[model samples]
Target chain A: MANEPDIQSDSLLTVEQAIANLQGADLGLRVYAAWWLGRFRVDAPEAISVLIAALEDEDDRTEVGGYPLRRNAARALGKLSDRRAVSALVQALGCSDFYVREAAAQSLEQLGDRSCIPVLIRLLNDQVPGTLPAPEPPQLAQPFDAILEALGGLGAVDAIPLIVPFLDHFIPRVQYAAARAMYQLTPSPQANHYGDRLVKALANDDLQLRRAVLADLGAIGYLPAAETIAQTLAENSLKLIALKGLLETQLQHTTPPNLSQGAIKVMTLMDELL
Target chain B: MTDSLVSLIRAVEDADSSNRLLEAVENLAAARLEGAIPTLISALSYNNPGAAVAAVDGLIHLGETAVPFLLEQLDAHNYTARAWAIRALAGIGDPRGLVTLLGVATADFALSVRRAAARGLGMMKWHWFPDNLLEIAQAEALEALLFVAQQDEEWVVRYSAVTGLESLGLAIVQAHPDWRSQIQSQFEQIALNDDSWAVRARVWMAQQRLQTESIVQPRLEEQPSPLSETDWQMIIEKLYDRKGQERLVFAEGDPRRYRELVVAIAQNPKPV
Candidate 1:
């Protein structure tokens, strides 16, 4: 009933090798190996079924792949977009490992089929809204952020309902991610709320967070953000990268003369600040 | 500090997100990632409690290399520094921590802090204390063991002390059985309650060791097979009294698989 071409396991040897070796070793070894194999599944559809089995393993050390692997497997399975795998991934959000739960969230975004939007919106709140005390010494929390990125890349327009409120986060990373995700889900009425904050970030004195914000804006190509980009380009203090990006987009699509004119206004302001 | 470490520590202060920087440093220490000792020591003095806590964990992870640093902190002004050092030394199973732990157990510190020191000393006994651990368990540590045995407010400390006492041959209770039973009955509250995660985890570990020890033994209890009659009949007859005819018998099958054979009838029995 199904096509044979979609069922190949040969490309998934990395996952199989990971599984075979993991299930055979000591508990700690099994966990480390399982995590790596699960990461391989994120890009390989053949790994979805195997990952589902890993989730059912009762031994926490044997089953848990930590955050990197679990999240990717979830996202990867979602990318496969098989409706049957959705609930299994949902159950995985309850895996004992915090990172695995985070990964499950991101994978739901990759599926982008709309049915997962509600659960994901719930998770974004739990993970980002300071509901959980941060783990001691802050380990890299990539999965939740990765999920937000996936939602944007997959153009999950339904996500705007959840993504908008997080832009008000006191933590710059969460606010920056929410703003960027909102921009990617384009045409949402609430994009203005997030977009305005991004414009403010562009003017903030902290250069690193500021640069990260501009990069996201440039990536999203919000023509409304053209003013922010134009402002950065005219200042000798600001990097040429943001301006180059805005000018490139405008030149490629709109008339170049209009951008040059906008650049003139930003230059006049720069002259005053000096 | 190495450039990468200084950069990461700086990043910890300046980071928009403290997540990865903290993890990298901690993992490096936990694996006893060598040559990272100096870096982690500097981080212990960081302004942020979170960063310092993270650094302390890294130091704990470094284990023995942190001993000198831990020893130095035994006299520090910072309560947090002293507290974390006690925890790290205990976690590393270092015997040097015992004196400080013994001192702090009686010191007028916060109950949590005192409980932490007592628990750390107990943890060291299991993981790295000297052979006198069992001796210490039997003699000088009874009151503290009893305190941890019943009254400590924290379960990690309480369970650790109880389990350590149990592992050291149960001498605290064994030296006097009736008193020991009473102690066990009192602490049965923990073994059965199932309320605290720390208690449950330690219980699981303790029970696993108990089960393993009981089921394994050092020697295989089996006897070797006697020599076949055909191989040494005369030699056997010379050693035995009045059973010369019965001393020899023969079978022609594999000895290990089909080894049964009947000896010859006794000549004395036949004559009588």
Candidate 2:
């Protein structure tokens, strides 16, 4: 029985069963189990321990499609958001597989641990400095965006200089990510004071640029920009996002001042139009 | 800062071995080094599929920077070089390449080149550009894709054209509303009548996707667990036994190997 594969309803396995399956010989079972444990997120020490342990399981020697078990484990650990998995996730950053490294970085972001800052910064720096402007391919894993977003989530102030250059990157995704990360790292209401590249980007003719900047301003809760964003509602190209930013600003604002009131008016108007 | 990349560019030029040339192209593209565009364009002509794929990826990575260089290669004396250049440009999806792709998709001598062009026509990534031109370009692109889908000789080319047809409509059908009929007619025609099984199958999937678009709320982000608190607790106890080392074996015919179970595990039930 010990050697007989524990093949529970592959998706419905109990956390204990899934953890045990993580140690199983069949590669697919291990991958499935790791994913299940993460989905369960039972908040058990044993579940996290097994996921971290699975990170070192390179035993699946099949070359086709690469070994996905470890990658799945890393992703599961991220979903679990256990601080205990931080060191393991950080180590997985250097894994040879792009998916594994991506999974590790994304998990670190989800974990929201500031301790992962140095590693995230290092990974961001390692990316090819400049690439042409393009949307991130739907299926491609974007390590640069993952790293920058992690740094921003962690609020690494020192990473601002590193994140700044990417603001002008030709890749629209990278440019948008750089703006968002900078917004996260900079103190709110003071984003414009810190060179506010997103604000600077608002001057560009690119509608995507305006939309991304508006989203970031709203996300960062930069209340001062609410009025400016509201002004764009007259332009059909920018109206929907302009309204979204105003709504976000209104909701996230702690202060009930003219800015908040104006946001309310704009949001109500947008709602009525809708 | 680009010193190492400069050395790689020289290596690509001077390398005696094909393997070295390919490696140099990979390094240049990975690093996204300056002056790697011409080298990547030249490497596309190589017989090696690995190197050719890498070159295409490299040129695409270079984005608009490689557009002019790629366009220039259409006039190259070598036909193989011209074909590869079309593929690279197609992969890049620049609006500048649209006319060239249309021309090649219809008249290119090589069937491979025409197929590549057809595939490129489908992959225009129109949203990447400024919005003012989107409506015009989308209309033009759809017309061209339909032309290829209806008239292309090779089943492979038509298959690719069908994909383009689907892509051109998927996004705007909901918002424009008027596009719904045209998209339905095109996709339904191919889904029911396309001769090749592969083409018919792809068209069928596209048709289904279009039919369901309005009913299904497109999922933008991962959601929480849909399993009830009781169900979650039940699954938890059964799976969370830390002391147990042996794995649970699902019977061979277990019904849990389906998407519904995953949805139950992964998605949160909405509040009534």
Candidate 3:
């Protein structure tokens, strides 16, 4: 008789070990477990419940008043593809730590929950009093980039008017997020105009901003930008990833045997990069 | 070497603690002794990142004097030491390191090394080269920079290439007036099509600077005689060589008009 290993048994062991570490006293191990569960896409109910509980973790605070555990947990929850963690992620949007809030917004986007749209939009207009401007590029207190990106991914078209002003945001990265969200919310024909703003942002001297804009272009499947993305001065790896995003987007939106000229161009570019 | 320099060198080589090595390197670097160059360069091969950084700073402080030693001591087997050596060579901006800088900027496995080398290429001390050799050197530098700008896989390196191009362009325009049109055209193309917005933005800033800065004007009066038909034909041929046939084909019907158009464009290239 041929012996086949039990894949289910191995996964169960991993899930149980991750759950134990998540509930363990060691803060570092808990953080690792949270990341492991989400990274590996563990969808166990125990994993979800513990990750949700971790969002409220009070013990794992950074010297600068940031919540490392809460941040990692929130990030993992989104990757698990579980809707059960959505409410906890939404609540995490109110965390004092900007990164925690950013992480929460990103995960919430991954969960594809529409209920978080109102909360995210409110953050667009959120005016935190007494908060000092960011050291570089001088942005507002809220994680506007993440919020806007999440809103766009959720297809919240109603948030368009509110997001428009952020195109003029002082921080270029935030402006890029606004442009990306605008492109996502606007329908085709009108959408390329917003995509152009991102294309223009690709000229910014900040590598991070260029990378972000490339990602935004890819996520929106902005095929008009394929040539530009391919030629962009970013690392080939990042350029390839962005092009793949565009290709995936094209595949999903087009029918078989009728790839648009833009799609064909994107594939050609990807071929060259590969 | 003085007694104090010897002791500092000993401290750098024999110190077990990272902090001690860093302090020794710092003191040695601050000493600015010519003899300390070898010791500082040796410190680069040490495992401690902090000491290596201090050693690089010290070598930079040594400036032109350290260039020859830096070039000779570049470790082919040790990437960390080689990277630090590149940084030192880049920081000094010595003409002697130009070949090394060009080689690494184009082919270094480490992105940071390539980045430093790319930036260094633009800032070489042109005055150090003899007038006869300056033109040739600048041309080589420009070609390397153009290749890096268009071809480097990393945006930051490409970005550095733009900076190098601008600085070198400024130097070339001052020294070799005939090269301005080519430099201007190169910048225009980079600004229009470079994928990284940062690289594009840098090109824009460079164009603005080139326009606003009145570094040098063409010395038309210095020519002993006016351009004859043969000279004009040669100029047209050179233009064709640089821009290809398609770009120059527009003014084929009228050579005078073509010459005028070329002059106008070269005198006032369109802003990116």
lDDT tens digits by residue: candidate 3, B30-132: 8889989988988878766557767787888778789778887774567778877887898777766776787788877777678778888888876544343
**Among all candidates shown, the one with the greatest lDDT:** 3
TM-score-wise, the better of 1 and 2 is 2
Query: TM-score of B chain for each model?
Result: 0.53, 0.71, 0.74
Candidate 1 per-residue lDDT over residues A1-274, each given as its tens digit: 0111222343444655666655564655455555555444443444456666555665553222344444444545655556667788777765656656666666665565556555565665555342232244454433456557656766777777777676675567677887778766767576666677777788665556776777767655455676665554222223233433443444444341233443333322322211
- Tens digits of per-residue lDDT for model 2, B181-256: 7766876777567665445544655665566765434545633323244433332233223113224444575433
lDDT score, candidate 3: 0.74
- Scored against the true structure, residue B97 in model 2 reaches a CA lDDT of 73
Query: Candidate 2, residues A4-44: lDDT per residue as tens digits?
Result: 22334444667778778878788778888888887667668
lDDT of 3 by residue, A222-259 (tens): 77788888866564456766876776576566554345
DockQ each: 0.01, 0.01, 0.01
How high a TM-score does candidate 1 get?
0.34
What are the candidates' interface root-mean-square deviations?
A: 30.5, 23.5, 17.3
Give the poorly placed runs of model 3, Cα more than 4 Å off. A1-13, A127-139, A256-258, B1-272
Runs in model 2 deviating more than 4 A are A1-274, B128-132, B174-176, B212-272
What is the docking quality class of candidate 1? incorrect
Cα lDDT of model 1 by residue, B131-182, tens digit: 2222332333444555664655544346446554444333333245654554
